[model samples]
Target: MKRLIAWISDLRLAIGLLILIAIASGLGTLVPQQESAELYHRVYDAQPWLGLLNGNAILRLQLDHVYSSSWFLGLLAWLGLSLILCSWRRQWPALQAALRWIDYSSPRQLSKLNLAETLSCSDASQELQRLEDLLSQRGWQVQPHPDRLAARRGASGRVGPLLVHAGLVVLMVGAAWGALAGQRLERFLAPGNELELVNRRGETQLTVALEGFGIERDPAGRPEQFRSQLRLQPGDPNAAVPLPASTETISVNHPLRFQGMTVYQADWALAAIQVQLGQSPILELPLQSFPQLGDQVWGIVLPTRPDGSNPVLLALSSEQGPVTAYSAEAEILGTLVPGGGPAEIAGIPLRIAGVVPASGLLLKRDPGVPLVYAGFAIALAGGALSLIATRQLWAIAEPKQHKLHVAGLCNRNLAAFSRELPALLTELQQG
Candidate 1:
């Protein structure tokens, strides 16, 4: 049992686990997560990056949702346990040892340290007092003994490793919590549309109202940027009837943060278009993607007669362009530009009216985001603290022999400490 505990607490084991987790995270980034099974099948069947592994294999291994997978969560749990065990078995004890003073009976004991030096003095008692004063001035915690003195500097450096491990554990816990309970929602909403924020349990928490959506297009008629004007209400959907004063504008790279949720403008699409069919009512037809026709093109099929006969396909690539009318035989019938007069297509007059644009908003709520940010801050502070060298000095003053035996040790930056120690000892001996 002791051996098992030691193995689990080993630094090598922790490093290996961290490397494995990094590799798994990389793989997870490569694979899209939480997509529909049909999308996975269609994507993988078309371009199978991994040979002999299809969508079924991906689903079986839970690779589609890697962060939420049992194996990934288990890895996080194991790493957290390892950090706790390692801190308990090693860092805590080391910190305690660093904080406590270890009195050396003789200067010879201090001489055995990793980086040690000896200093001689003419008047042992007077020199020892001077050295103690100097050490105190330099922020060293001094412990006086009958014949000797033990002084330590940077004792707090020992706590760095502990904080580092603690921060790592906290970060892991935050990530796990986010994977388990965080919410993500992506929706295409038209201007003036409102939706209630719902959790995984389908409980409405808040209301999001879209005031306006606009798409900035390039000279080539391609969308360069998409922006959404939004208003957030505190209560449920019904409570937002009068609208709220809390409004925010979100663009492509910029997002709006409210409460614990973030709203990102992800994409844009053509929602619907108004069309008039020969003295008939102006029909608002919802457009659907027709990738087979052209890129970024949307189309709709409308019947010429009220009896639903002679269906014709109307396709448009952009809102600014001409809409091509196609006959039932896949032949071009006529073209009508936006706001242009009615054109004859299969003996029916058609006119292209206005187009409605929709904005794609991605909402995310991660309860653990604050914890994760805090953990990272603590880790950075600990890393900076670890850079400081913990140094200790022991001195034995033999007044009868008129000799002071001084020895010094440093855990890190020994060369600099070595030069500084001699200079300090020389100053004390001269005084």
Candidate 2:
């Protein structure tokens, strides 16, 4: 049991676990996560890089959602346990030892330190007082005795390793918590459409309203930006008194944050277009993708006569532009711009009233984000603390012999401390 605990708490084991977790995270980034099994088969079945990883293999290995996978969570759990154990077994005790002042009975023990200096001086009492004052000014905590004095500085450095371990554990816990309980939602909402925020259990929590959405296109007709104007209401639909709605606009990199949830403008799509045909009621035609025709082309089939006699295909590549009509034989019949007057196609007049655009918003709620940020802050502070060099100085004033013995030791920056010690001795001798 002792051996096992030691091995688990070993620094090497922690480093190995970190490396494994990093590799797993990299793999998670490379693979599209939480997608359907069919998508995995369609994407990787014929790909040379991951061709051998079929749908079954992906599912069996939990590669579809690596962060939430049992193996990855197990690694996190193991690493957290290791950090806790190491902190408990090593860092805590070391910190306690550093905080406690150990009194040396003789100068011999002090002289044996890795960095040590001995000094001889007259007027032992005055020199000892001056040394104590100098050490105090240098932030050393002094412990005085009748025969000797012990002083140490930068003892907080010992606490740094403990905090570092604690921060790592907190970080791992946050990541695990996020992977286990966080929620994500992707939706395409048209203007004036309202959607309720639902949990994994399908329970509505809040309400989201899409006020408007727009896409900015470049000179070459490529999309440059997608923006969504949204409103967030606090409560579910069943609330007795509905909360005030807050409005926000989100663009590509800018996201709206509210009630611990973030709404990102991920994409945009042409939902449908309202068109009037020959004095009939406005027909809302839902657009379908025609990638073979053009990458951004969307179209719908409509009958020319009121009796649904002659079918014609109407296609458009952009929301702002000319919608082309095609005959059953695939020949171009006519072209009509959006909001343009009715144009005759196959002897029936057609008018495009308006285009409906949908905003694709990705909503995410991660409860562990605060914890992760806090852990990073703590880790940075601990790393800064660890850089402080803990230096110690000891002195004995033997008044009867009319001499003072002094020695210094430092855990870091030994050469600088060595030079400072000699200068301090010279000051004591001259004074």
Candidate 3:
């Protein structure tokens, strides 16, 4: 068990784990994931090896969803466990050793130490008091040691390991939660389409109504801007309605939040529909015979008159289609019908109906947002604190000779400490 613990504490194992994490992160960036199996097949057609990772094996097991994978989760759990154990095994003993004080009887032992400074004083008590005061003034929290006036400070430094470990664990937990519980859904509308928010887990629990959509163009005739205005509503329309004043609007970058749901501006399309009114000979109505055509022009049939006459016909076509009369302007006498001119196309009426426009929307919901943010904040703080602050102080005293010694040490950025030690020693000497 001791050997096992020691092996786990080895820096090499930690480095290997780091390498694996790097590979996973690299794979996540290289491969497109979080999409359906068909999309994966499309993306990885050239790399047959990747085909093995498709379907439910990738999705259900979360290999494609790397951040949420069980293996990734297990890796994080192991990392946390290792960090806690290593801290207890290594830092705890080191900290205890630092806290322990020994009466220095021989100068040889004191000289063997790193950064030892011995000063002879007539009144050791007054010097010790002044030294304590100086250390306290310099932001060092002083504590007495066993043998003599061993002023230990910066005890909070011990928490650095725990802080880093906790931060990493929280960060991993937050990422996992987001991968499992957050979602993105897209809906298309012309100018008036509505939809509900869907989470990563494939659940829709909130709805949003699109109030308006705006489009803008640039000098080059490309789409420079797309904006959408939306209002949030309770998914259940029959429930006690919320105040109308509470409705919020959202656009592309600006997302509207309601009841833990968010609605974004995703995309849109135009739909062209034909309208018509009744009866003509099967040959007379080109549209009645064919519902959909390679050419999009459609003919509408309307209600017949009191007399046994042909009904109104409205032919509608998109910008792509060009309309032509069967005869020259002078010869085309009476294909024209009602609202404006003569009505004699087999005694029928004809007119153009206005075009209609529709709109599109996107929705999202993330229950783990707060957790993710908290984890990031903690990790960032730990990184900053670990780099800037560390603990190192030592003191030695003998009861017989009433002489005292003190020193400081650090594992990193030693040059800065070495430079600062002279000044620190000067302050101690003045006492």
- Write candidate 3's Cα lDDT for 1-431 as tens digits: 99998887676776687788878877777665566788665544545435575444445555576766778767766765676677678867865765564444444565665667776766555666677777778887666545434444445555555566666667667667776777766666544556755545655546566667665556654445567666655544445764353456555577667667666655443333222323432222223212353243444444456763444434434212222122222233233322233233433433222233234565666777877778777767766656654546555555456666766666567777767766786877764
User: Any residue pairs clashing in model 2, and if so which?
Assistant: none
How does candidate 2 fare on TM-score? Answer: 0.86
TM-score of each model, paired residue for residue:
0.89, 0.86, 0.66
Q: lDDT per model, in order? A: 0.85, 0.85, 0.56
Better of 1 and 2 by TM-score: 1
Q: lDDT tens string, model 2, 1-431?
A: 99999999999999999999999999899888987788787767767235567667777899899999999999999999999999989999988888888887676786686655555556677778888887788778999887689998888887788888888888888888888989988888989999997666776778889998989999988889998888887765567787788888999999988889888998887889899988989988888878679867889988877798789999987888689999989999999999889999999888998788788999988899888988888888898899988887888877778767777778778998888888877876776
Residue 14 in candidate 1, Cα distance off native in Å: 1.8
Q: Candidates 2 and 3: which is better by lDDT?
A: 2
RMSD values for the candidates in order, in angstroms, are 3.0, 3.3, 9.3
Misplaced by over 4 Å in model 2 are 198-204, 217-222, 236-239, 275-282, 290-318, 321-354, 399-403, 426-431
Model 1 deviation from native, Cα RMSD in Å: 3.0
lDDT of 1: 0.85
